[model samples]
Target chain A: MGKGHPTAARAFVDNRERAHWHDTALWFVREKRDRQAGSLPEWELLRETASSIKRHAQSQLADYLLQFEHEATANGAVVHWANTTSELNEIVTELLQSVDATDVVKSKSMLTEECHLNEHLAEEGIDVVDTDLGERIVQMRNERPSHIVLPAIHTKKEEVGELFHEQLGTEKGATDPQYLTEAARQHLREKFLNADAAITGVNFAIAETGGIVVCTNEGNADIGVSLPKMHIACMGLEKLIPKLSDLSVFTRLLARSATGQSITTYTSHFHKPRRGGELHIVILNNGRTELRAEPEIRDALHCIRCGACMNTCPVYRRSGGHSYNTTVPGPIGSVLNPSMDPKEHNSLPFACSLCGSCSDVCPVQIPLHHQLLTIRHSVKEAGGLAGSKRLSMRLASMVFKRPWLYKLTAGLGKCAVRLTPRFIKYSRLNVWGKGRELPPTPRGSFRKWYDKNGGSGGR
Target chain B: MTRMEVAVVGRTTSRDLILNKIRAVELPDVSHPLVDGVLTGAIEYADTVGTFVGSAESVGARVHFCDTDSVVDIWHDICEEFGSGKTANVGIRGLNDDDLTDDSPHSASELVVYGTSGILGVAENAAIWVSDRAINHRVSLCLTQHLVLQIDAKSIVNNMHDAYAKLQDVRDDYGVFISGPSKTADIEQSLVIGAHGARTLDIIVVEG
Candidate 1:
């Protein structure tokens, strides 16, 4: 989707205010992570175990998915399979139509956003409202989430108060967090109680028990799912876990990673609906089967949907989620979005500084930076590289492949840098120099230095 | 009279043709083909649950056994020594109006012993979850700061399925499984442990 408010989204993606806001939000999550990590002595071991469980689940996802479909159907949850986003929309729309539904309440499900569910539902004359406070703010403003956990993070309290004032007509200057929270609570309470259906994202789907594990703060999901007549859960194929026992590691890590709490305010498990309620689980395989096929990049599927990697990523901490132009962003997004559409997302792989902070902090230990590099190489192989970038890389590769030419090229580069005008202090090749001064090239190459020093360089 | 008019109207009307053409058609077989060879178990691993216990005196939680008998005496002494009565709100499980009559002769100082869910180990950061099913009132765990969970120590498991299976038998009412103190560190990296939920948790494990 292009910017809903084209000017605002563009400004948020590229402007300094948005960058600072996103960085602060991510740092908050990072700090939460450190606190949670410090609470448990077995944190590292827990992370390792969690990573292993996710890996196992992703490897046998096909079997587990089939098993889940059978069990979920048996449990009275109508199972829907959608190979593409449009297909997913059609299936969900038909399901809604079967019941003659009009209004839907949704919790914070990134998959629904990924599939553009709200827009499609709107076109069908159904109103979809996001019940989560953060998501509601973003939805009201016609903007996508800037961060997974805190969707409206880029907007400050006053900005939110202003928006709420304009939309909900609260007091003109209500900047109090409690007041704002209470207002949202009252507003969403009505939506949840009245909506014909509820939509949620699954944190973990247990194959053994045929249950969907939904973790949330503020208990919004619990209210949304329990109160509505129909509950629909949309999940990517990768969200499955093999055994119910495996939930311990994920549940433990999710709270610690997300908000530094031991667990969410609510961890709801729905196997089958109650007496009057109906349940539906839509399993989507848009690109995950293909993602599973790439061995080098398959670890990307081990993601626990914890935003820890995004919080710890330097590039993501600087550039908000909107900059990536995908529902999921950061290092994980760079790898995952490309798998869905390499040509469109080729620019994302190179958006990082190759820092390993994401890998270090990842609970599942998906080698995110490494996967981004792998995706870059794959994009290059597929000839998705831009014309100018391809030409530049090709020329550099040619020179480096030939040592004599490389030396000659280095000499010319040094001469050009030395002779450049003051207005052009450094070559555009100098990215680091954009923020800091460039180092002066030595009078000659290292070979010349070695020759003059008689090859005894060290003191 | 209705049949003749209907036949005449049907023969005379393009509306009949339009209505006939508007009959619902069968939908196409649109199920997405399932993909093969998805990896189910090659990624990450972790055990899901953990359990721990602390005495009423040591971890700041009170014990309520519901009588002035020898067990109550022992529990009071333990609560006094552990500083639980000072820090915790306590409860007893499954006691109704019938159980606490004058013949029982419970102590005057014995606080209201509600229901017991399970023992809880609360991190100092003030986060906890107590099973709503386990407690008589959900507020027994939510309203208190330091909770002393008094349960049979053997009930603990390493994952949620054990708890879930246990819950399946009694699905008529509400049940809460608390983890730690209620907490939210969402405001600008500040780890305010007791934002709006519980502040501290201490599980007083009675060995017997």
Candidate 2:
């Protein structure tokens, strides 16, 4: 079983200051996304277009993948298929070993993280370096990325300064972000120059011309791909688009919804292999086909992994990304994780407040809250629902079914609450009363007071 | 090769297994985005160059707008200000593209600057479209310490919709929409320039 959400969240919220800092940082990004969305006259139209395009592509996934494979092969790319994440890791490791590549540099590819590719490669005795600054920081600390885009969002500069001192040998207490970033630049450039191979994640794979797009603000993907003789691109099956022209719609919305930039600094398109080099594209299914069969949550597959939902989600911001304990964390992760293992990740669906902010902020318009609620029902069907929640829900349904019983119980409950000792009412069993309190006892029940006050519309 | 040994199995069994699994699942056929009557909202701007400059500067790139007569002088001043290091001037009017093909320029030069034309500018986002046709060596665009690019003032478009409509002219084996120099906000959301590519990018918008 996975570490439960409530258990993990308690650890993060124990330090009130850090929790508030994390909340404020994510909120800042959310506000920036709002400004970008509001500036465009056709923002809603763009979202609808992108969503439909993804839906169409997904329904015809088999044909599109075939078309993309044919086109990419014609463009001189070697395409590999993997039914499982470990299969993907095997393919990547075999490719690396064939090239005699020991020192590998990889850009931020969450697919690899999901499959534990780094660990697998290390066991094979190949050294891999994460070129993205945020990813490098988290890798140095031996931790998973908390946020997809902002991998180091959970870390503070002062903490980074301490990390750099230990890892990159920076001056002690050098908390200046500029100085620290420069030191990282010097450190990573050496790795880039010496890397024997590079790996990247595909943001969009076009089927028309057989091209793959990788977007980054730091240009690490381009540098890594350009310098190495053997390069590998890892992609989920959901990354394909039918044609080249579809890029304009997705590219316009991706950055504005992400970090609120009009566009990323570098949106590089790699159609062919480098001069006298090799290009390998690994397409992974890894239980996504099962998710496609799920009618209520299949819309989650349209996600572009922009992390906007994570930025806007109140529960995600306060509880932190580590609380989810998944490769991709936050609103989308909560929806996708339970599909992987219902019994192990059943806590994820219950970790939401049913707030629709994530859906509203989602550029692809995934019905996240509705999906979470639907998944709650599915979890109950699978017998993975928590015991207390099932019990309370059962009692609530029984009480709500009969009006006479509810009224009689409410009158008696008011009397009992007023007469009981304070210790019993606020006992540990009352989880609702932990941070909140019951309202003061009324003089009489609402039904009795309303029935006697007046029968007319106005009193 | 060992890669081909593993490739044979990966291409056949795994491919058919995945495609078969996906095909068995029935899903509703949805309309393509373009066919669904959703327009791109053609945003027209009166002053494309002005809009391009503002957008580029907002993203931390410096844009120098000039005419054909005095454009080279601006590049000279820019090169002088940045440094007198190993600059790779590619297809510039007053400079030569000789340094661009230096043997291992990335390791040899302290600074490799590429002053190339064939850049298609977008007004909405300051995205300058470039491809292999512009410069023979695409890696220099990233390995350079300082980058100098040229774009025709008349070639600037209003938005990405218009830009993509006209991308056929420069689309090649590789293409990029470079708005600014490489930057990162990974460490505590702090904006740092020159993450792994060119530290400074100056786009010279030339008008006839």
Candidate 3:
């Protein structure tokens, strides 16, 4: 099982030792929040406006898709549609085969990961190298990214040094970030210069201009896509925007929220292919349309793929990225993964603490917690609820329906809090205690204290 | 001749043929008139490129605001970040006449800071586009442990047209538009920001 594989929960448990790295990562993001927000005193207004723009765009996604196909085709960029992962894989493999590409360099495209493109490509005897530093690390380890922005954050510099030593042959014990970074640059540069074709993930596809925007901190995306004669851009259909003008607000919010930078190092804009460069835009449905059809959850399509909401989320910080067990994990992923295949991804919705920090930090202002609750409700409605969970929830609901019973149950809960041992005997109960401490119960309940202190009416 | 690259799937039915027989489909009405002069105004002032600052009051950051081909002043401002470290550069607008020497420290104040001409934003994606020109060492934007960018208020535009129209004629080179930080939630569906890029961003907006 892979590091993030479902069967690899034991490995995940071991990696929880690095929870401090996770905490530091999130704290760093939290610190950047005010600077990013301060850049636009109209930050909230801009978020509302962006949400509306994404909503309006999603409402007309079908039209935009058709328009994009028309414009892209007219501009000499081929457009292909894939309703499933297999279809997407086939299309890409065929394109590669058609071009006789042996070694393909790819910039950071989460779509390729979603479709498992590399494994399929590898099976076909095509070697694909991820040019992003974090992607490269995960590629070397054959592990899925632990975090979207910092895929290799779970990896210490020492570990990276070891990986590079084994893979790239840097002397025995060089763990310097700068030295390691230079080694990566030197190594990836060779791949960038010689690759037959480059594949990139599109950050935004401006439908009005029929252009694809690729953002990266390293210049890898530009080198990969521009140098190659055949360039392919893989994007979720949800990546489309109605006009080019809309990129401004997102540019302002995306970097600030994702990494607290004014901007990513490189934002390459490609409209059709350049001279002697062939461009292709692949629009993969792969469950996006299904998500789009659902009114309550359709706004998920508006995600600019900035990882801000995830960074601010407490549960995500503690559990780390591998625990989510999906191509895209975290708050947005919890709501998004289900839409891809609800039955298999049902566990994702339960992965939240419902603190609503995600909604607060979301650049697009997605009501992430509400969407999560909706998914949880839907999962329960689908009869997928576990027996113990259902029983507990049912008992809890029953007490709430009757005041006397509620007070009696609340008293029982308070007593249990005091009586339950630090080491819970139940294996299932102990799972909840793994990441967090159980709150201590006072001699009396908060309600009782509030009542004695005088209620809101007294104030 | 090479075989046609089109894929052959199921046979086309008469119904499909009839559907395809339609010569043209009705197109949606797109009546908004393109404003010629409206785009030009921003393009003219677009030359009003500026550098970024930290906390708006830093001395070097201030000199970056009023840059005018004086290499000595630029070098001095850059040196202030380090307090008392030698710096090596091809040239600075305000500080040095001599070429950069080996005595220069790699950084000032623990980190070296540089300015970009301006920042670009993709309104559609909520991303801020900064060019390599603003960054030091080209990879400084992401490579440095800390990076600070100063952005002007008016450079902001609405969408891709604004981005293209402003820099459409820019010299062929590298540019980037960052949206927040580099991030991913690829783990157990837990969203964590600051995955691979800078962990923090400090933006100074100089108000006129």
Candidate 2 wrong stretches, greater than 4 Å: A412-422, A437-459, B1-7, B35-38, B102-109, B168-170
Q: Which DockQ-derived CAPRI band holds candidate 3? A: incorrect
In the range A176-215, model 1's lDDT, one tens digit per residue, is 6656665676676567557788889989887866778877
Q: Write the per-residue lDDT of candidate 3 for residues A1-459, one digit (tens) a residue.
A: 123223334454556557767667677777777676875556786677678778766656666776777767777888776666776788788889988999999988888899999999999999999988888988999899877776776677778889899999997798766667767766876786578888988998877667778777655676567556788889888888776656655665777788776565556667656445678787776766667667678778889988887788776776778878887888999999886677777777887779998898898989999999999999899987767678879987898899899888789878877787666633455444544566666787767777888667642
- TM-score of model 1 (CA atoms): 0.73
Off by over 4 Å in 3: A1-17, A416-438, A446-459, B1-208
Every candidate's DockQ is: 0.06, 0.68, 0.11
Residue by residue across A397-459, what tens digits does model 2's lDDT show? 999998888988888889998898878888987766665678889896667777788577533
Q: Return the candidate ranking by lDDT, descending.
A: 2, 3, 1
Model 3 TM-score is 0.74
Leading candidate by TM-score: 2
TM-score of chain A of each: 0.89, 0.96, 0.93
Ranking by DockQ: 2, 3, 1
Q: By summed lDDT, which 10 consecutive residues of candidate 3 chain B come out lowest? A: B37-46
lDDT of 2: 0.86
TM-score of chain B of 3: 0.45
